[model samples]
Target: MSTGHVEYASLNGTHIFKLIGEVRAHSCISLDKLLNKIEQQQNVVGAIVDLTQTTFIDSTVLGVLAKLGLKLKQVHHIQAVMLSTNPDITTLANSMGLGQVFVILNYCGDPSVCTLELTEEQHVTHSAMLNTVLDAHKTLMRLNENNQNMFEPLVKQLQKEQDCLNHDVQKQNA
Candidate 1:
């Protein structure tokens, strides 16, 4: 599988993100930053995640997307839309209860409406990556019972890693 990259564009009040190749936790920091920027913007009307070209996406990216869906609903009172052309990706999203947070459609929306520019990839620290991963799984677990059961053990493991990282940081500072 090819390495993944994220592209983004803001058209009018709508924001669009395109994920290509295999998206993983390494890309979450950039994705998270974009989501934060959108959340802060006024006049934001809609959000769309285009996964037509996405071959593979890991749990961390999914969690960020889930978090985006929930935030859009909570802060802007608008439900986010996710476009997935691949059946496998669609099935994965559905299994993770993304349908509850996003309007999962099987077709690619109007691509000509906005030009998706590539987001600048940012390097991630181990501490940051672990934190993002842990928070993401926790968010996914909040979606439904199935997700909760599926992610609880992973969350527990991530929490342990986070604790260890924190301890090491403290010792270094001491």
Candidate 2:
């Protein structure tokens, strides 16, 4: 099944990113690309992550969003607001200590003015995906003590998977 997708629009200075359906590691490439595009914009002041229609969000995606928020704050001196009505998502963000990075909102004003720019999904190698997932989890781990405790096992698992994949690729090449 298709995991998830991201749509984004830049209006004025704030970039609006909408997460539709379930989001996983597969969506990170496009998301990262979009982030780059947003960075190139002339007058970017902030960003908003809309999760109103999202049904599921994996740890990797959450980590990516958290990192985005922190970068916007620390580097750009702007706030990244996450528009989410789902209690589960809100709770998860709080649990991961993302509240420090994101400003969660239940409603949005004039979203109609924003149109999403959707792109074809990017294909990533197994090792690449594994690395991305591992890095995302590491980012999450830096959020708080609880996040560190929660993602430590996942980080170790990803590391093991990456190691196995590397070995398999090496054997195939040999």
Candidate 3:
């Protein structure tokens, strides 16, 4: 698979996130942070995710993107649009119940705007990575019963690890 990088552009109040190449859990932290920032932006009226260039997207990236769609729908009352020409990726999105939160489209008209690239954070803590992974799976679970069944064991394991990590932190602090 091709190496993945994230590129994005904000046009007026509509924000477009373009995923190129292979997108995986490593890029999810930056993507999550960007999504949070956009959610807090008062001017955001729309959201779009372009996956035309995406060769692969793992479950973590899918969860993060799904969270973005859910947040846009809940906060801005706008259904996020997802542009995908690749059949495999499109099938994955549909199977994940992403269609409920995002309007899947085959076309994305060119937008005349400069794009910025998002890079992964240099140093990510184990706790933070664990939290991101756990949260991403939880978000996925919330999408449908199929997802819930698919991710329950992983979520349970992550939750246990999180509890232990919290206990360790408390002990060190004490």
lDDT of each: 0.87, 0.80, 0.89
Give the per-residue lDDT digits (tens) of candidate 1, residues 1-174: 228888888878998888989988887887887788888888999988999989999998899999999999999999999999999999999888899989999886675655555654556588888878888898899999999999999999989988998999899999
* Number of the predicted model whose lDDT against the real structure is largest: 3
Clashing pairs in 3: none
* Ranking 2 against 3 by TM-score, winner: 3
**Model 2 C-alpha lDDT per residue in residues 1-174, reported as the tens digit of each score:** 456678878767878889888877788867866775666666778788888878888888888888788778777888888888889888877888788898888874465655665674556777667777787789899989888998899899888898888898899999
List TM-score per model, in order.
0.91, 0.83, 0.94
Q: For model 1, which pairs clash?
A: none
User: In the order shown, what is each candidate's alpha-carbon RMSD?
Assistant: 1.8, 2.6, 1.7
Task: Give the CA lDDT, 0 to 100, for residue 101 in model 1.
Answer: 89
Q: Candidate 1 has what TM-score?
A: 0.91
Misplaced by over 4 Å in model 3 are 108-113
